[model samples]
Target: MSDLTKLNSPELSQFSHILSHAVKVPGLIFLSGQTPTDSSGKVVEGGIKEHTAQCINNLGKVLDAAGSSWEKVVKVNVYLDDMKNFSLMNEVYEKLLPSPKPARTCIQAAYLPNGVDPVIVLNHPGQIGAGYAPVLDCHTAHIACKFAELLEKIDRRTNKSIEANPKTIKSGDSCIVKVVPSKPMCVESYNDYPPLGRFAVRDMRQTVAVGIIKSVEKTDKSSGKVTKSAEKAAKKK
Candidate 1:
């Protein structure tokens, strides 16, 4: 872990600008964190209103690049450096509107320069099938059965009762049955991982169930050492 005390948080004079002239038509114009700065990137001597207007003007150039005006933007996201100046920003912001106003949200999320993907968690140790994973770069087979046994032990210790999440994210939330079967017994989807989507179901290994669960495949050889492709992708995520 890095030292938080040594972290760098510089007081920026002006926020950055991005421009793309390739795509035409109704384009997006981002008015980024417009701090007080002059045309030469120098700090200007003015109030927040001046800096805010400059930011709006800079966004106008971006809008012009697509041969459309700022009035064409259907959406707008605002960044408030000074909460005290929010009303000032709003008053200036309303000027950009012609007849219909853009949909807007007022909050303090970071000023991300461009688009980004949503992140998700993987290998949740508390989740089912997660215990089967090898720890600390250890061999997966060595601890694979340990994880399975741990489940049986947990069931017996906890009276074999389990609860299913009503609005579950995955099949791992399946309920565990306490009672023993009479004959031709089968528990339920008690060993399945949480459904991650079509990708997870598609990339599941046939051998994980056959070899690991049923012991049908010889795992003593390197050829037998394999993991679900979906699990690999999940790890990457």
Candidate 2:
């Protein structure tokens, strides 16, 4: 239409009818935010990290169609349902984008369309290394060795899951580990895989807790000094 250029691609056709993936003019281009949906419009498997990867991939397709590339991108806006995922998302983002990085802004949303609620831990053995970052980001060696070590300790303690919070960090081997202590409440009915399916469950077997560590700080041991309620006490003295 006129001098405006609209772009689309088979790889990113899921929302073609609803919206243009990108639009280019004489000197500038505007790109729509790509979600984790595949060609068929279904949300992709894997957790936020994987989803973010897919989104970037989709953007690549759109960029290619527009005759542009990551190197040309001037800005990026990332929307997350949970801000805690900032680190994990960074991991994948750093791997994909070009040097110097694009001007970017990330904001947490109360909800994402695919129902990726961060409050639940959605890793079943079938979807191992699926959702939560500590597990999802681990490699085969980490799982086979580090995870096995943690599992052995759990087995010895007669526990289904182990808690390593406040663990003394004597070595890299010693770090926090998380697990679902009980069976997931909405398991058999949901099989989408990883974090999305897990987060999609209408009800749960128990309370849910899964995610990355945000911050840690040392507290002051000194007690607070009492102060007079009013300056009148000093004046009277």
Candidate 3:
């Protein structure tokens, strides 16, 4: 198609004869799946975490060739050789992508090129559901018991300036907490919708802390604007 423009990265020139790193048309860019291969087309050495980073890094080159960036990516598809590596792969992924992360689908693949552990495809500038849900802030009202949890901590060395690790929190401690919903739900800021913003921290029959939602970060489905909402509700104290 004359209108379709193929985009190729000099760093990934080896793929030119077989495939374009990406294609562009008007307002959208479609990027091909990128593996952990380097410019020489050899799989990089490392574990799944390192492999995932390389895959996203390769995509970055294609995005640059297309005059686009990761922030402009609206959808992504991740292929993993094993579901067990999902968490390890996500460790690298969450750090690389920017706020309001793109909509993504990850599934296990029976096999991957070059025996790589992961492959990623990216699509730019379009609406796909509500986009990624990012926690704006979490304030702990109270802690009922001691537990270990993965919490986001400041890491100036990383691009995102934040990293997650399991930290032991003691009972009766007041600390910041992060909540991740298992599925996408319509959420509003506590300031905007009290009823929708309220939430409770519970584990089985034990109610930990009850508090109103301070804010939720999400991309509007239609306008694509990032919005925050708060909530007010009751919880067992």
Candidate 4:
């Protein structure tokens, strides 16, 4: 019921935190998140596929503490650092769900887990279902989620561009951004497009979703797509 998104991270346990309060509310976790490596403080090494799998496992610990599991998850917002990793990343993700698929949104970020800024809602899945957003201040997480969604639409040349809001700006050109379920937004072109690296900041206080402009390209390099959660998502019924 508030605009607060916390990316849970036990490794950076001292970054931003909360009390051992009951789950009287639903919220996003990840006050800060990074690549998966170890509970003892070692980020696993590998390509997008390896890092992603470990990241999801690491997220499990965080979600569990928040009293929510990926099965209870209603939506998954992804931040891929490289566009080339998109397909491989999706292949990894599609396999993780448990069924009745939750609405999913994906975006490419320059980085994630650096300072840990991905948040998760702690509410039970029964509290929120597909097609609806979490009843929490996922503004930070949600904003990035929406920004990615909006960009997708625009990239499709659907004609709707992102409308800038003044209050949404936490600083600099960043605005207090929000995405409409379906609305008309004017698209504007810029010369200095923000780099993916700048998007996923390491230690940010606000729910910051950095926007990137790019064209999807095809490559023949073997990605070896893998998914450990997709079947779980499909069998949850």
Best by lDDT: 3
**Candidate 1 lDDT trough over 10 residues, lowest sum:** 193-202
Q: Per lDDT, what order, best first?
A: 3, 2, 4, 1
Clashing pairs in 1: none
State the lDDT of candidate 4 residue by residue for 1-237, as single tens digits.
565544444543222322321132444443234455565444456777887787777666667667677777766677776688788887877786567666877786543544222222112223212232211121132221122221111111222324422222212222122222222222211112111111221123532223322222222336642211000000000
Q: How does candidate 4 fare on TM-score?
A: 0.39
Enumerate residue pairs that collide in model 3: 189-229, 189-230, 190-229, 190-230, 190-231, 191-230, 197-231
RMSD vs true structure, all candidates: 19.1, 21.1, 20.0, 17.9
TM-score each candidate.
0.33, 0.48, 0.48, 0.39
- Give per-residue CA lDDT, model 2, range 81-160, as digits (tens): 78899999999999988798999999886545445222233323222221232312111111111111121112111222
What is residue 148's positional error in candidate 3, in angstroms?
A: 60
- Which consecutive 10 residues in model 3 have the weakest lDDT in total? 116-125
Candidate 4 worst ten-residue window by lDDT: 228-237
Model 1 quality (TM-score): 0.33
Tell me how far the alpha carbon of residue 221 in candidate 2 is from the true structure, in angstroms, after superposition: 72
Rank by TM-score (best first): 2, 3, 4, 1
The deviation in Å at residue 83 for candidate 3 is 0.5
Candidate 2: pairs in clash? 185-205
